[model samples]
Target: MKIKVIKRRGFEEPFSIEKLEKSITNALKCAGIGLEEAPKVISKVLEILESRMVKEEVHASEISDTIELVFIQKAIRNPLWLNAAKCYVLYRIYSDAGKVPAKFSKTDLSLSFNALKVLESRYLLRDPKTGRFTETPDDMFKRVAYAIAEAEKRYGASESKVREYARKFYEIMSELKFIPNSPTLMNAGTPLGQLSACFVVPVADDLNGIFEALKITALIQKTGGGVGADFSELRPKGDVIETTGGVSSGPVSFMKIFDMATEVIKEGGKRRGANMGIMHIWHPDIEEFIMSKCGPEEVLKNFNISVAAYDSFMEAVIKDKKWPLVNPRKCPEIKNALGKEVLDIAIKCSEKGVEVKWVNAKHLFDKIVMCAWKTGDPGLVFIDEINRHNPTPKLGKIRSTNPCVTGDTRILTANGWVPIAKLFEEAKRRGVIAGIVEKEREISKLGEEKGYETEILVPYGEKLIPTKAVVWKIGLKNVCRVIFKEGFELKATPEHRVKLKQGPWVKVSELKEGDKVETYGLWIKEATVERVERLGEHMVYDLSVPGYGCYISEGILSHNCGEVPALSWESCNLG
Candidate 1:
């Protein structure tokens, strides 16, 4: 009878001595043993295997165990053999660990075992008394579909239309063609219908504004949303607080408070709380912000930091000129603050009245590059470029993007908060809102108010603009988290641009701490940076507003609906 080996999954295959020899040879190489000794090692292992071959078949583990035993005996003569034994054992463990479980079969929908595990742990609804899963993956999909379809009723959709759309929704979801943000996945069909994933809260220069933003951040995070904000407006460290006759601790100090708050809420929130911090390059605390993540102590792990750079700043760096760091508190009062050239580009890029500090542009740029290279932090966002392409410039310049920079956010449509992705689907499929036909009147009403034809309108400020188009794509890319001093956070692709304090655009990957990005409210404001973190690669989405070139996500003014080229997907994570 042919010698056979029983695999871990209870399957038998013909035992191949050649394959075993190769595995042992690789292990010996890793132990720094010469290849010439591989044959000698193989012979010794074969002797043991032959002794154990009493039956026609044997477990795979038996062969591996015998090899390990032989290597252990050799270790007494040479310690390097011990490494070979460890290597072989680790290889076996890795092979077993990587084995995929059988396909999930509980539901009609096809899903991997890993996917099923995720659903069971986080997505599926649970029984109140027993805390066991109350529904299957199919049931969860149906629940979400039915609940979302029910919303059509509020918008004048008939019973038949609602059911029809629900069926359609179910088909796409069940087939794995379309999936909504995490909040929609977890909270939809449940009482916790707060489904927005990214928000931008304003962090003004005062104590009240900072704390208020923190409060809003906590609330949104509790509902599984991430926040982004610009901290550039806050006075730098040691700035006199005229009201209390005390020195300000600056944005970096306040960022710690936000970080602590996020850490606390992440423990209890429906999902982990995340933040984006944007500080302007001109801020006096720019150095501190850039190095925020580089501290010896692990601080601001919950936040991301970016430096808001400008065209002039980059130009100055290239020209080896001095760049002026202006005081936000005094910039507005300075004559011609937004002029083409400051006092003199060569000497100082500042007006006569504003308080400014000069730094070598190349030096600053080098610091940003070095820090990012070392710690993968303080990404850059070009404020001017983002505004130049702002789809909804009327909405105020986009200061910060959503957590994912993907347009998985809800656009404040005339009808209400509609998923931007859904609108994109409508645009892609039919170029109109025929599926959600009820929104036509609301869009028309909004257009009438804005003095434009209402095809589909997204709010800008007091006005609304017709949505020109919604675009989407598929690819793996780096998504970064940027945290502001007052606890605002946004996640976007590395190259996504955000507004700087002085109204310039810079990339998220190039942002350093103390850079101020735009934040939305009655008007646009700057939030200073706390830190920046690379959250790794993910499949992202984008939404564009075309002429408007921007949209308000949660409360932040985001470029072109999301970060760059449109939207980013920010979903709720279960663990």
Candidate 2:
């Protein structure tokens, strides 16, 4: 005869030996006891349950009592069983107590004690007169559900349909299957009604623009939103302010002002204010930005800073090349020398207007890695990689991310790209392939061609090697127009590696007017640079090939991402 176990609430269910075994095994594990003897101990406990089989239903407490009695008997042979018995009893007590809050003990929601405490303090509506919690956990879920579902009325939903949807929403929330963002949980139904968790504010390079962004940031944080801004537009430190007749203090100094404001304003007066500060790699004061929060003292405590590393900078780091830090104000004017056969942009910049500083890429990258290890302030944001997945190409470049990095852009996939604005949309989209991303988590493969099916020509030292496209990507990269004296032109990122006549890889930015680079058509041939100039921004695409880590782009040899060597090596002393 099958026996049923009667719960404390008077609900009866068939006794599950599997559940009993799992519970006893958990108790044993918690007490640091071996599980090898668990099955034997469980069998002894089951011997007692055999007597209760004559009854149609057995009280749940009786099963617990029998388990405790068996554990006590086992304690005579092994003292560790006593600890296991105590753990088993304590588990029962807490599990019972955790079912619901004291006032709503009969409610079906199974919330832990800590969860209830959090709800009472931050979520549960309180009585204005008494300042005591006026709503139970279930009531709190219901209030949020009803308020959100009521919006369906505006969308032509029927009253009965609205209630039904609200019931479903409440079911998901109360069961802990799904929880909305914090702002939605906190102020969705409240008067504040601000449901956004973060906002991106623009900061132009002027007095009015700076203060305007600051004011907007403060107001957003007041209503429970964090703020993020790219400070790359702001001129470098000591740049002349044409109107004020005083030199600008730079982006880092302005970041301090914003950080101070964030320190004073609590988000929604309930959460701490947060901000993300980003500066481009080409920004003249990038080193200063990287070291802003490097010390033991708390500096820019409210802000998280990141260097908007362009693909060129990363490529420079991997190839042990010099990375140029340029003034954004000078970029447009420098492009004016479009047809000039310039020796170097920095040398050309001096003739045009301002001088650019070139730092050893590996050394600078080491400083970034060290600073992140030291204070965890400065992190790298791959600007080129980010712009590649831009869905709205016509709407201009995406400058800043939200404080916690939420955006509805897109990702690279085979055949093209797909907008990642909605999860369901991405799922239904064709040409999306699976690949391993950071931390071994699988995501849509970033590609421009069918990875396994497509092959490309990769330059591998005096030979054009056929390589399969493992992955490919499409994005906006700062393209350098290199006109060869051999009557051909190639465009790619400044740091893109091309083969030199001496059989070494050299960056496009470092290639001089007379530098001879290798080219491929029927065979590898030498092409001397006639003119090297900045071609402004453009839609650029590249493929990731095996072995050589390079591909044939516009007849010139080009390297793929710089991640391979940078991630594998520990030494930064490579010349």
TM, every model: 0.51, 0.49
Residues 496-563 of candidate 2: C-alpha lDDT, one tens digit per residue = 67778655677778898888786665244778899888876654433433223455555565554432
Residue 194: error of model 2 in Å?
Answer: 0.9
Candidate 1, 1-575: lDDT as tens digits: 37888876677899897888887987787678888988887888777777778887888878877887888888999988877776664344333334222222233325543465456445666655544455656667788888899988866889999999989998898888998777777778887786677666656577866886687778778877887766776788998898989999999899999999998885123456888888777778888898889768788889877887777888888999887776656552211122233334313424345467888989999989988998878888776565566676543333222223544545556566555456555555642211111111222111111111112354444555444334443235568877878765766777666666555567778888887776654234667778989887655544544334566543455656334332111111122
Give candidate 2 regions above 4 Å deviation: 1-109, 126-131, 332-351, 391-575
Candidate 1 Cα outliers beyond 4 Å, as residue runs: 1-109, 333-352, 393-575
lDDT of each: 0.63, 0.62
lDDT of 1 at 471: 41
Worst 10 residues of 2 by lDDT: 566-575
The number of clashing residue pairs in model 1 is 77
Clashing pairs in 2: 388-475
Q: Score residue 412 of candidate 2 by CA lDDT.
A: 29
